[model samples]
Target: MGRVVTLGEIMLRLSTDSGVRIAQADNFCAHYGGGEANVAISLANFGHDVYFASKIPDGLGEGVVKHLNRYGVHTNFLLKGGSRLGTYYVEAGIGERAANVIYDRAGSSFAEMTESEWQKEELFNNVDIFHISGITPALSSSWKKTTISLIEAAKEAGCKISFDINYRGKLWSQKEAGETISEILPLVDYCSAGKLDALYLLGIPEATEQENELVYYYQEIRKKFPAISVLYSTKRTVVSASCNELIGTLWMDDHYYESQNHVINPIVDRVGAGDAFSGGVLHGILAQKSPQEMIDFATAASALKHTIHGDCNQFSEPEVNSFLLAGSGKINR
Candidate 1:
């Protein structure tokens, strides 16, 4: 199995049932999720060896590690006892709407973690791919420094690096974020972006549907990050709260390949669909699937995720392939 290492904060997630606002809800379901960690979990479920590195409070952190281990993810790199787990509240939408999140991550163990807490050599040693996200760098200035160090070490170790520009507006301002992400664009092997994220980083306004926008958008982004090997975008058209159509396209070696759209009529939970798509694409790269097939499988995997709750990491390979082949079926493997 290929060894993948992910570095980021893992937060405790609380979501109210029946679509009640956080202030109105008396209780909520709790789970664990963080972008890089979620991607690592998805990869592990596909049978790839994966590890997640982050700092957490002792008991709560141990619980997170044990949960990750249950999914076959290596948790040895997880550090504990710095502080409490970061948390967020989710209020899922009903009918024709989208979900919302309220992050309560400040002062959490991960946000307070020191650069000394990360043992770069041991974490990246013999690793096939190193994954990171914009979320970590947005946490604090210390995390920004930590992220830079981690990327430098991974680059020196000759590991493939994948970055997701998961811009959280609530975490930081646009100018500061644009400047920071632009600085690191040259250092990554693969970069993922949403339409808004691309426009935000490239300084382009959202395009009108009539403009054949992807072409122009691609040119601007590629010009900005000439060193990036693969630039992927997850395009989604939210038709309704229950229905959305998603597609995957990549700007690779000066060319772009657009894949088919996977439609979901009743999206159960849209949280981690993009991460699942990235996981599928990464898996396809390791399995040597063609670019088109990679997008296909990735799109299919992501579409399937809407039928499941929490994050897409809970899905297995066979389950995704079943949806790919059978159109629809029980999600369990």
Candidate 2:
């Protein structure tokens, strides 16, 4: 397995029980998660040597470190400082009611992270891939610079960069996201984005009525940012709060590949499915799987995430493969 490094914030997630509303909840369940951290956990579960880097409050960050360790993610580059960890709340959804997130992350430790705090040499040492998301840069102005610096350092260390444009509207505006992400895309080797991102963020014009929309957008993206050799995204059809249909797509080497559509019903939790898919795709790339296999594995990993309750996908690579083979809702015993 390859060594992977992911940099971003890990926040405290307080979620209501199933069918419970945050407004009506008497108590909540707590878990630690964030985009990059969730991806790191998923990679670790697949037996990758993954390290997660971020700043955490000294006394209050123990649980966060323990959470990473439990999933076999290294915390060596996780710096200690700042007054408090970022946090968010999730109101569980059922049937027609959609889930919602409320952020309380302003001025948190990771948002206030400075570039000088990280030792680039140690963080990227022998690392095969460096993964990150747009969320870090959206945190604050300082984080924007730090995110670029880390990407440059990882590139210098000969690590392939995997970037996910996990744009959060609450943190910044579409104009801000488009501007910042445009600057970062050139340095990225593997990217996670959709047709909407291409149109709005990259300023690609809408496809002609005859051209395949996603394929045209992806091809144009490659023309603009040739360094990015692989691009992937998922098409999600929300049937209801408890049911969804998902399909993973990958564009590589002038070819596009798609996975079987997975109909996830009675989803236990849907918080980290995208991160799980990202991790699985990275794992497939590192493991040198075929494009078809990569999309299939990634889609399966995403489907499995909806079956778990937390923000991390706890399934292993073998488990995901087994799930794919057995299909959904079947007894293993």
Candidate 3:
């Protein structure tokens, strides 16, 4: 396999215990999470050589780097020595309301990065694939400039680029997100996002259920951004806070492939499931698996994520395959 590089910020996630609010909690589980980093970590866990580029405060950054190294992610291109580490507080929610996230990322190292912070060769030197997300560009103006510079540099390096919409409402407004994403779409090779995210970034009305909105949205999105040759989407139907049917779909060369929805009985953690799916698909592609296998593996990986708490990329391939094989479909994997 070749090198895969993900460009983004890795924040220290402080998550409250189940049913506990951030203000009321005395203890929280600490973990590192970022859309690009999450995908990179998952890919590394699946045996791919992966690297992640992000900025962190010297001390906290060192810890994050060590953690990534433990996960087999190359941190050679990471930048350190900043004042503060970005953080987010997550409170697990049940029933009608979804999980809540509070950001404390302003003035963080990554957000303060200038265009020079993105050294092309350091990250994309030997990289075969480069992955980025909308979340990074939405962080701040400087980050937006860095994201664009990195993408252009990756293209010049002859590497494939994967873009995940990852539109976070809390990060920016819909109008600005749509405009910015529209501008960057032409530079991306492959793209993925949830239906709502695409709709938000593309300013399209929500498509009807019978229309298979993901395919419809992808078609519409590709029309404007012809360079995006491959598309992946995760379809979700929230049954309750603890239950949902999650499916993954892939669109490439004008064909659509769908995966069976794995019903999550009891959701342990909602974060990083999409990144897990992206990881599985990218892993399948690197392994040269058929589209069906890619979607199946990706779906299985995501289903397993919902069973584990705190961004579960520590999973192994045997674990994911076990979930796909056994009738139990539980998280033992």
Most accurate candidate by TM-score: 2
Model 3 C-alpha lDDT per residue in residues 249-294, reported as the tens digit of each score: 9987777889987788888898999999888888877788888888
**lDDT measured at residue 262 in model 1 versus the true structure, 0 to 100:** 76
- lDDT values for all models: 0.81, 0.93, 0.83
Q: Against the correct fold, how does model 1 do in TM-score?
A: 0.93
Residue by residue across 72-167, what tens digits does model 1's lDDT show?
888888887766888888898877656888988888988987675766788789988999989889988877878888898998998888988888
RMSD of each: 2.2, 1.0, 2.0
* Regions more than 4 Å wrong, model 1: 204-211, 329-333
Better of 1 and 3 by TM-score: 3
How many collisions per candidate? 0, 0, 0
Tell me the TM-score of model 2.
0.98
Report the lDDT tens digits of candidate 2 across residue range 154-264. 999999999999989999999999999999999999999999899888898988884557888889999999999999999999999899999999998899999999999
* Window of ten residues with lowest summed lDDT in model 3: 324-333
Better of 2 and 3 by lDDT: 2
